[model samples]
Target chain A: SQTIHQWPATLVQPVGSPLSLECTVEGTSNPNLYWYRQAAGRGLQLLFYSVGIGQISSEVPQNLSASRPQDRQFILSSKKLLLSDSGFYLCAWSTTLNYGYTFGSGTRLTVV
Target chain B: AQTVTQSQPEMSVQEAETVTLSCTYDTSENNYYLFWYKQPPSRQMILVIRQEAYKQQNATENRFSVNFQKAAKSFSLKISDSQLGDTAMYFCAFLGDSNYQLIWGAGTKLIIKP
Candidate 1:
């Protein structure tokens, strides 16, 4: 079975500080990885997705950026965090097109 | 562009009763996929059921099933014998066969009162 792991299940960052959230998948290779943010009482917003290493697509324009450093490792980063950046960040992976995504537990970010 | 909609904002059901959540989507693509995801209080998204556009027969899990109407663009989920653990926020999702992205609906909050 495949498993997705995210670091710092909960994070508290100061405004204007930098941010980095890591996601790595085990037991699968060349899987599609995605980054999503869910605001309180809102739908899941797709921030970025990577089909392969060094290939990334941004779904929405925001302060966050994504990178696929390794085949199974994906990273979401920001140089300067904003108050609006606070939300529950999730990382997901899929085997192929139109397949159901397996999401991680998620990282609750609180930017104060 | 594809869009998903969950008309119901919230629904309540008695324990052991059956409940259905409504969902509709808009898309121009002929080939696509529909999915239902569950998000518990923990906020973890879990796949509940999925239906392919080309399949005529409805998809069913142990206690969950989907009524897929391709022409109407409607896909609804029916949960049988609802359990307290089944209480969660349900989201409808649509994905184009050619794209790796998924469009999500706001979600329907389902509560099972015992």
Candidate 2:
């Protein structure tokens, strides 16, 4: 059985603080990992996706960046967070596009 | 640019009744895929159904089914015997064969009342 773990669950930080959200998968190898953000009443926005370790493709240009330190570990980071960066962040993994993605529980970050 | 549209922002129905949610998309590419996802209070994105453009038959999963009209570029989800558990936000997504990412609609909030 495959499972994804994403943490802090929820966090509140001041603007200009550094941010790091981690996501890791268990029971799967070389799966495609993706980072997405959702704002209230808005659709999910794709931030970054990784095909392999250290191979990242970004969909949106912003203060956010992604890294795949391990085959199953994907990280989203921002050196200096902005107030507008506050939102619900989700991590998803997929073996192929024909099948739907398996998403993590998500992390809610409130930048005050 | 490709786009997905969910015309109905919200819908409400009683228990055991049937409800249909509408979705439409625009794409010049001939081969693509359509998906319907449910976001419950837990906020997990659950894939309810998926329709492949090459297939003419519609997709179904138990009480949930899709009415896919490729010519009209319309894909609608029909929920039968609706339950209170069905109350959540539903989103439609489009994935083109040549594109790596998905284009999602704003989303439709569905409320199943008792």
Best by TM-score: 1
Candidate lDDT values, in order: 0.95, 0.93
lDDT of 1 at B25: 97
Poorly placed runs, candidate 2 (over 4 Å) = none
Cα lDDT over the full model 2: 0.93
For model 2, residues A1-112, the per-residue Cα lDDT tens digits are 9999999799999999999999999998999999999997778999999989999999889999999999999999999999999999999998777677888999999999
Q: Using Cα atoms with residue i matched to residue i, what is each candidate's TM-score against the true structure? A: 0.98, 0.97
Q: Ten consecutive residues with minimal summed lDDT in candidate 2 chain B?
A: B94-103
**Worst lDDT 10-window in candidate 2 chain A:** A94-103
Best by lDDT: 1
Query: What lDDT tens digits, residue by residue, belong to model 1 across residues A17-109?
Result: 999999999999999999999999889999999999999999899899999999999999999999999999999999976668999999999
Task: Tell me the lDDT of model 2 at B40.
Answer: 93
What interface RMSD does each of the candidate structures achieve?
0.9, 1.0
User: Count of backbone clashes for each model?
Assistant: 0, 0
